[model samples]
Target: MRKIVYLLFLGIWAVIGPLHAQTVKSDSVFLKLQQAFMAKSVGLLEPVLSNDFSVGVYNSPIAKYMLQNIVSHFAVDSMKLKAVERVSGKNSVLFIVYPHGEPAITTRAWLNDSHKLLYVDLFDQLCGLNRYKVSTLQATIPIEVKDGSIYLIATINDSQKPLRFLFDTGADGMAMRKSLADSLGLRVAREQNTSVVGGNMQIQVSTGNTIHFDKFAVNNQSVAIFEHVREGTAGIIGINLAYQYIVKVDFDKMIMQLYSMGNYNEEDKGGTTLSIKNGKGILELPLNLKVGQKEVTGNFIFDTGAGYYVIGFGDFVKRNELLSSGFKPYFSSTTVSMGVSSPTFTGNFEKMTVGAIDLRNVPGTLKKYREGDERATIEDGSFGVKTISRFNFTINLAEKTIHLTPNQRFNTPIDFMLGDKMFSFNERGQLAVLVDITAEQLFKQGDVVLSINDIESETLKKDPARILKLQAMPSGSKLSFKVLRDGQVVTISA
Candidate 1:
């Protein structure tokens, strides 16, 4: 009996020792992940971040730009990891984070056998939805529409022959390119006059119906088509389809899910709830401010499409007496393009306060306009992605709630011009790269630039056989240019 008891004790001790060691290792792994996230180490984070995450907040420029700003400015003031829940029989863990200066955010981290995080999902607590399962209409590749209310994208056409569309939720209705519509043999019924607020833009809407997608077919019942849209997009699915379902955009797996009415799950809601008012969506946040030593009430828009921070000139001027009292521009090297519809200013503020929070040396752009009127349309200075990206935020349309959570994982501000460049093609199929840099010695916008060493876009397109001969040029590579600036022909070297 004593020998049996001894054997049992030995067996229990052996199991418990290994279990305790595993627990320690798991804790260590979690800590390492937290450290990497806080450091904003992209290389170290690459091993842990899930590439298969999607954020389809009705494709509003606000949500897109806000999240983009967060990733770009990858730094946070404070991050508190409050708790972690590990599910049985799964390699995933749920984390609840509290940000000091911002709102709270919930995220999921999945580990591989090597104990490295293979996936991470940033959740919008208001919607309780992830990238993959935000909707019920499931397809590997889907299309999208950008109405102001919903960021709607869908998998159109047959499953065997699939077509994907991305709709801008900021837009009014479904739209597509003329060339694409012609290729599809779509017939236009009538043209209606339509106008957009920003940039003094206007378009002619054409209503038509055809077989949109094979699986998610849109005859006359499912869609209304418009042509010659804004924002240089191909086409849209629009509010017709979006209003009927809860939409989700899964960027990770490159898929879209649409949930029918009364079919949403209660797992984890994301985004802030919103309300539609007088043909516009209103997301009002309470704020306290002083106007001439008198407290005044003010409301701002949650505009994601506007990329930077903008403030009302009238309000600012009245409070600080800036217009009549001239001040020097903060930065000496500031320039702007002709068609970009941002405000103009010659002064900068050392600090600006939002509620009780004070932002130092906040780079604010001032615009000339009334409180809420732009080109005869209702206009309000919006809180753009620049300020919103400092924390994780969501708007719940269902609950009519707005939630703001500070994100601690980000602690680094990204240099935009140093990271990536934009590219497009002219009408002649010649690729035009809108180099996102202002190297006065090298290149400038509207320069009708010729070539960068051997990287002549026109030459490359004409000669397909010489594809392999092309290579990436160094950052500061020397190049010759034939520029057409202000109708004069000049030659320069850099």
Candidate 2:
């Protein structure tokens, strides 16, 4: 069986392209606005946007509310428009935003017949368009989740801190790590069989006193604490404590905004929201999904922590015949580091279609272990950067909706995707390769990348141009690298 894998990433642009008459010329208009914002030109945006224009940053009425709530006093280091494209016959312009230390982004704006801005919407790489507001506040909160009812994770304090907890929307109460529980002198929530939509699991839970989130503090909060939680995960602030207000996740600015839920009165909101149905839940998107000839539907966890797409092995074996098709398919297998126990087997699958977009050769892994007669079932899974990089996603938790837009910069370089290749940072901050290898080469994982042809690693870091020429190298051909293994530098020809 032939194996196929669909991979994607954020893309970047070098220069603005020339525009035809009715279309706005892409020169520095976007960049100038970015710089103005960075320079705190709060008074200027009003004129540029004009009174006749209404900018909706997240495709909802709340977009304005978000910005107004935060921007009353906010500061930004920088905001750069990497690329711009005209949509809907020049009436709307889609802007892709790239900010330092933030995830990839794309946003949409609509202009009235008079060329005045009508509305704007923002999209994060993982979650789709969310109600967002640009604020002068220099602080930002970033969140991520591996698995759960809610796809997002929250960080209240400093993001770089060694001790931190993720916010879970599905958990009935709060949870905490054993280490933090020990330090806080709090007892673990009593262990019980808690039933979640995904499945039933055992966890410790307890109530807490006060929960602090930056300047926004909740006093005498009924917070649940879980002990013996996974390592590196200090605890969780779940939905039982969440829904207090209108929440905004601004990926472009790398900020998470929390509003008093009372402020959200307008019914119109972002993306489709999820609701309980027959003891399960459903998050409906506007698009349809199909696999092979069958239409696939179910509740799926929008997990960002899963580096790769995963599915239950039993379903894979039952539904897919790739293994017996006579082709040797290569699968990415790694240790399951989430909880405890031994390593398990995981296989990859091919071909997954979401509406008209067909992801060819997309890889999947078996998520559960198998014993004779004992079968395991997995909750549905959704694509992440492993495949979602092809498009921009906007997740509106308030509305429980997700929006997908074609990502212009869908294929760009990021550190996470650089695999098995030895690299050093060049002066331009780009990862520069110090060695070259081909399909036929035996490039072991730990093989020290010494030098490229004659250029040494040190020299390559100083000059990235050395490896750029290797792009012309043919597959299956020998590429030489001087490597130091054991000790001495030796030529390890690939």
Candidate 3:
């Protein structure tokens, strides 16, 4: 009996000993983290953080320089370890942090096999903690449509004056022009290189800023400042808003609705419901489209920031051999993002099936990847606002679903590309030739277009609707352009 009791005691000690040690180690790590925040130093965390330490659900590894920048400028007043648990078979701890002059944040940090800190997810926590529950239960804001994108009024921290912001589902988080940030005097916390549609550029991140959309406000948010944005808009509000609220965009009514996630009813919207894939920071949806007679099925990023109907990524286009395929090509154009432009060819698709709805004769663009272009590696492409605006859509990130109901423009014919020339508005709101594929080269690239078909550039700038009119001109129609080339105004006709 004594021998059996000794063996039993050894078994009990074996079970409890490691758990106690783990608790002690976790406490030590938490203490070091708190000290780091208190001192606004990353050095205190270096000893315990894993060599492969990353941030967010996307597992983006933080380099030493970026970590130092972020930690030194972190605005947390204090941090406390609230709880520890086993999450998805990994050791995880919860922390409650108070930002100076802002609400508290409850985030989770994960530990590696040796109990070293591996990852910290702060954006998800910020979205979860910020909830809106007013008497009306929803907020409706008016929107303006310009250049095939939706724009709305917003105000940055402590400012009552309104700024124009693009409602861009393509972007992961909030972004502003560097000029706007400089004017607002926002301090940069960290700087990182980011990939945009056309090319890559370095962007600065600013934290602890509040963005207000009428009465609805997002506090303690991070904003990416870019060197360039659309000409007339101050910044962009991305899909992060849907993570906190059920977002409904009504293009026909020119309004957007925001509802609390818990109080909203998906069934009431009455549209074809589709599941949304939670990507690194973007949202994706399955797309079944038909080009000519061939069926192409894949996932596409739902991008409200993009102006065209659809654009196939280089990988998707190359794998499917879409350029050589039998589809008829319309004209050559360029896709621009952050002031960088890439060559693309626009064509018509037989039909694009979105849930039960079938959109016929839709125009799509295919880009030919440049050598060493990083965007060529993406698996799929995006559906832009020109296509999305045909439907009244509701995005509920909490439920990972999107409800799309076709509106009055569901069957409207897409604007046919007029010729082998394409133009876009420059930063000064003047039209410039982006691409000219004609054999004669009637309009050269970088030519400032003064008038097209007697419509003045100033009029086109003021009335965006006229730009669409120019795009929809019937094929075989003769067109003339008054352009500023070199130092003299020249008239070109084709």
List the candidates' TM-scores in order.
0.40, 0.45, 0.61
Off by over 4 Å in 3: 1-136, 267-269, 373-379, 417-494
lDDT, model 2: 0.41
Sorted by TM-score, highest first, which candidate order results?
3, 2, 1
Better of 2 and 3 by TM-score: 3
Ranking by lDDT: 3, 1, 2
lDDT per residue as tens, model 2, 303-392:
333344434333433343323433222333433322322222323234555545555444444333334202223334434334443333
Q: What ranges in model 1 sit over 4 Å off?
A: 1-167, 199-202, 208-232, 235-242, 248-257, 263-266, 269-304, 309-365, 368-375, 382-396, 401-494
Question: How accurate locally, in lDDT, is each candidate?
Answer: 0.42, 0.41, 0.74
Highest TM-score against the true fold, candidate: 3
Shift of residue 382 alpha carbon in model 2, Å:
4.3
lDDT tens digits, residues 1-494, model 1?
99999999999999989756555545554565566556654444444333222233332323333334444454444444433434555455566555546676666665544445543455232333354444344333342312111123333332232334444333334666566665655556655444333333333344445434434555453233443433443455443444334544432222345554333453335433333221242343433233222333344444433334434434433444443444443322221111224344423444445544454434444454334334323334445444554434333333223344433312222111111333333323334344443455344555554443445646644553332232244566554546556678566665
